[model samples]
Target: MKKFTQYVFCITILLSCKKIGTPELQPINLKISTVYASTELGKKLSLSKVLIKILNVNTNVEKQLITDANGNVSFQGISAGVYDISATITIPAATYSSVTGEIVDKDVIFNASDKNKTIGLTNNELNIKLVSGNIGNWLIKQIYYAGSNTTTGAGYRDQFIEIYNNTDSVMYADSLYFAEIIGRQSYTNTSYYTLPNGQMDWSKSLNMPSNIDANNNYVYPRALFMLPGKGKEHPVLPGASIVIAQTAINHKSPFTGTDGKTITVRDPSLTIDLSGADFEAYYAPFLPRPLTSDIDNPSIPNLNVLAYNGTDMLFDNPGRTAFIIFKRDGTEVKDYPKYNYPTISTPSSTSDKFYQIPNSVIIDAVEIQPNTASDRVPKKLGASLDAGYTFAPNGQYSSQSVIRKTDRTENGRKILKDTNNSTEDFDYFSLANPRGFK
Candidate 1:
């Protein structure tokens, strides 16, 4: 009886010891402060904010909280790690680029250690741009790079890009050229580029005598697609837009391709009825390419693939790409300096195929990236082009497209936001709703 009682007591103590040894993890405290970038102090940001959002990078978890009057926010006992914090603060209307009711938004990444980690969110208006005054009327409103999923579960032919005229007058889409940037962002990382590599590092002027527009224009393009039309042949009136498709046809209907094989779209709604699309991009030069799925519409004019530096111009599913629609003016291709490499990435590889486009002629430009921050590329567009880059949540082949935010409508014209910052100017949809018809 004594031995049995002792064994029971020992088992009870062992269970208690295990409970004491394996204590639950205690959370840590995180603090956040807000500020507005000061050009006076030169990059010094002042604090001001009412609310803030803290996001866990890995877990996709988010928390919203109000900041104290002093622009400080505290998260007690949060799992210590890295996080992205965003705060939108209303500043003096005259202080920032945003005119009326515009809020200065700032995002800062913080690493929260065991103790308290104070992260500062800075609203650097130095790079913030406004949609008014200088914003062009024509914009690349939407692009569906994530092709639809056909019945066979493969789809790329349904890709399309839509252009809109956000002005009160008609804008011609005629003779407009579309170029794909060859490099991620030329000025992103300059230390790695050297003259022996043929890559033009914006840091160093080639010194080779020429009137090249290589100063402010860093992102260069190798592929060029042009919209062939007379000056007024393709008139996109105010509040109007046009869809440029890979093939203008009802993707749902069964169709015969170059191989004389019937292709069917398993899900009708999943696909888009682009039969009425205004423009198409057909690899005219590479026509009859084996197993070429690209279909040409007899009614729609094709966007001549003027150039193709990459293997496929079908736009990458996740490749960070920057694009611009510019009218071919007197700017001679020879006038611009050349980045003599395939891309800034492959600096050692040689090629004289890239040319820089003067920013003035670019009607509108947009940069697409992956949903996550680390998957993003160095932003190529200046605050004048697009303040930031946007991405599809589902990434590739998800049929999601980045759509521009509507600022307002003036005199029957839809004035889309052109703050030159995609983060503030654009958002994503569950589906690619082209021309707002989703």
Candidate 2:
């Protein structure tokens, strides 16, 4: 009886010494469903496979998977956390009628550590039109809109645009009018937007010609920076490019802004020396203080500013704007029609006036905006003018640029992609590639 009592006492002591701990963590299951299909032409309508990339925002852990025919893929086990999943798919041009599509969607999610979840992706349809109009022998090669590196944290003075002759024969840059568009970015801001409430009424904004339809003709820029030349003063040969700077004085050198403060270029390698630039946007001496960033280069002719709104000839450093380069026959000021912008609410105000230049004169056009999709609005340029839009990645003064992609070449002439879709035609580079081509 004494031995049994001793054994009970030992059991009680052992139970009292036991420790408590949490249960082990369980792995997560990830399932993705892609949206795809087939067409009447027996071609697969979408990408044969989908690319799924999941990034853990906290730990920076990455997981990738390719979806099969069923548009389905699953991860066996994943340690759950906050993740950003970006999915992309491309349809072959052969499948569609010369017009194919590409889709990309990035997401943010908080996944549970031990749960099976499915991410259903909505399939987007993009109809990329083959260029209806010939993109011409000349192309706008690179645009350094994001400014340059500076020690003072202000470096937009180096803003420059580059053009190229992609044709076999020589083309003239003479009499080319480069313009910066000014208007509302999206339809949501009715008070500020040109066409509020997404009105399809073209008569409200455009000044159409008698022979043209309002749908085709668009509202052109109010002010134009005209390149002064008679006929062939500026000739661009095949496989050649020209840089147009705000100041063609080796921007790599130090520059003084309106503040009269010296701004040192942090990385001269990041900027180019445009000392031999083809042209520069030179404003007149009469131009006031703030707009005086327009440095004068006597050797490089000034682009005549045709002002309609009485505003200075300048660019909005942080605004959603568009640009175009065009040359037309009889492009003298008289050839274009006069447009008076009547505020949607106040038609009699006569606050805005414009000189409408038709799309026929536009050689090339590019639409630029902020990088986010939700922040973007209806495109200002027509589908025929520019089917897609491109942007500056990191807001204003980020030192980024939108560079055009080379589509193909015929003979020896390089034909940059003129698909009019910025998504396909343009891409973002870490640093600006200016005058990379002579």
Candidate 3:
């Protein structure tokens, strides 16, 4: 009977231990502090009411909180795990202009992010520095790189880019230069020059200036074109946009090609009518024999082809490309130095050269990659220019385009979102829209 009693006691102890299991994980009390960038104007700006987002990396759970007047927020009793914290705030244009003495017609966005942060017993505090982005008057509203069906649709010939004036005043398109930023297109590591992040290292190029930063301060352009206008010539009204087309012809309707043959699309719905495009890229004058569809539009003005690549202004249909628009401050683009690729061995004297553009003059930029993550190459632009890249989910020849999201409407003026993070600011359109908003 004593043995039976002891067995029951032992079973009871085992069950109690099982119920207790391991001691519950101790939750952490995390504190986050937000600060402005290290600038005179930034120091004077207020940091209160900034939205803070904390994403638990392990659990895939997210929480949001607003910062106090002192720019501090505390997360009490939170699970101890890795997290990604981000802060975003928008400053009114009047407030920014008054503080900085800079004229801005639209609101300014500031963003800060700290990734892979751990909240444990020893580490429970984090500080995020918010950096202001370009108080953009013009923005790349849409990019239609992915064309429609190759056999039944317009293919790559319908690709175009739309730029919008996001301000409330008139803005000139005069002498505005846009280019296709060049970078490593594949992931294959080569003995040739490469940046630590797997991008092409232009500093190793022959005759590259030793005085200036070749990779960080400047970007190389595979193709460069500029709008032909004097100051105040092409005035884009508030909320208006300008579309630049590869061919300014109506793809929905049959058109006469440069080859004197008719060009038509089997699926008109898959394409867009670019006949109303403000500017068209005419490469026939520069190329010995341009594409048969590269016909000139007498009604549409042509972009000044400062540099040429391929046969036309053809974008990589699978994404794997980037674009930037900037205005000349003092120096002429023609005077800018060009250099060959950074080859292990010296390139030939007649090797092709690409023009280098300074980042200081860049007004806006967008980085793109293939729809699938496996096919994506290393990012070309830095975080300041574009924190994250965007892509069309349907991949190439899918008639898709990435368009900027509308943040809010102020007095009937549409303000597009510009967080410097394309992944969050952009959404893909199943069919490309020239002046459409999401």
Off by over 4 Å in 2: 1-131, 149-154, 192-202, 205-215, 255-270, 290-292, 308-313, 347-350, 409-413
Error (Å) of candidate 2 at residue 286 is 3.9
TM-score of each: 0.67, 0.64, 0.78
Q: Using lDDT as the measure, name the better of candidate 2 and candidate 3.
A: 3
For model 3, residues 1-438, the per-residue Cα lDDT tens digits are: 999999999999998887785333678788999888666755678889988888775676888899999889998888888775778888898998988888887778887766546678788898878876675678998999998899889999999999999888999998998988888888685845997557888999998878888987888889899999989889999988999999988889998887789988888999888999999999988788889989899999999999978999999888988999899989999998899989888899998899988888989999897876557676787656775678899999998999999988989889888888786789989999888899
Which residue runs of candidate 1 sit more than 4 Å off their true CA positions?
1-134, 150-154, 185-216, 287-291, 309-312, 333-337, 342-352
Tens-digit per-residue lDDT, 310-414, candidate 2: 323434445367788877766575577755543355444555666666777778878776665445545566545665467767756676778888767678666
lDDT of each: 0.61, 0.59, 0.85
For model 3 the local lDDT of residue 346 reads 88
Position 136, candidate 3: lDDT = 64
Model 1 deviation from the true structure expressed as Cα RMSD, one decimal place: 8.4
**Alpha-carbon lDDT of model 1:** 0.61
Better of 1 and 2 by TM-score: 1
Query: Clashes per prediction?
Result: 7, 0, 0
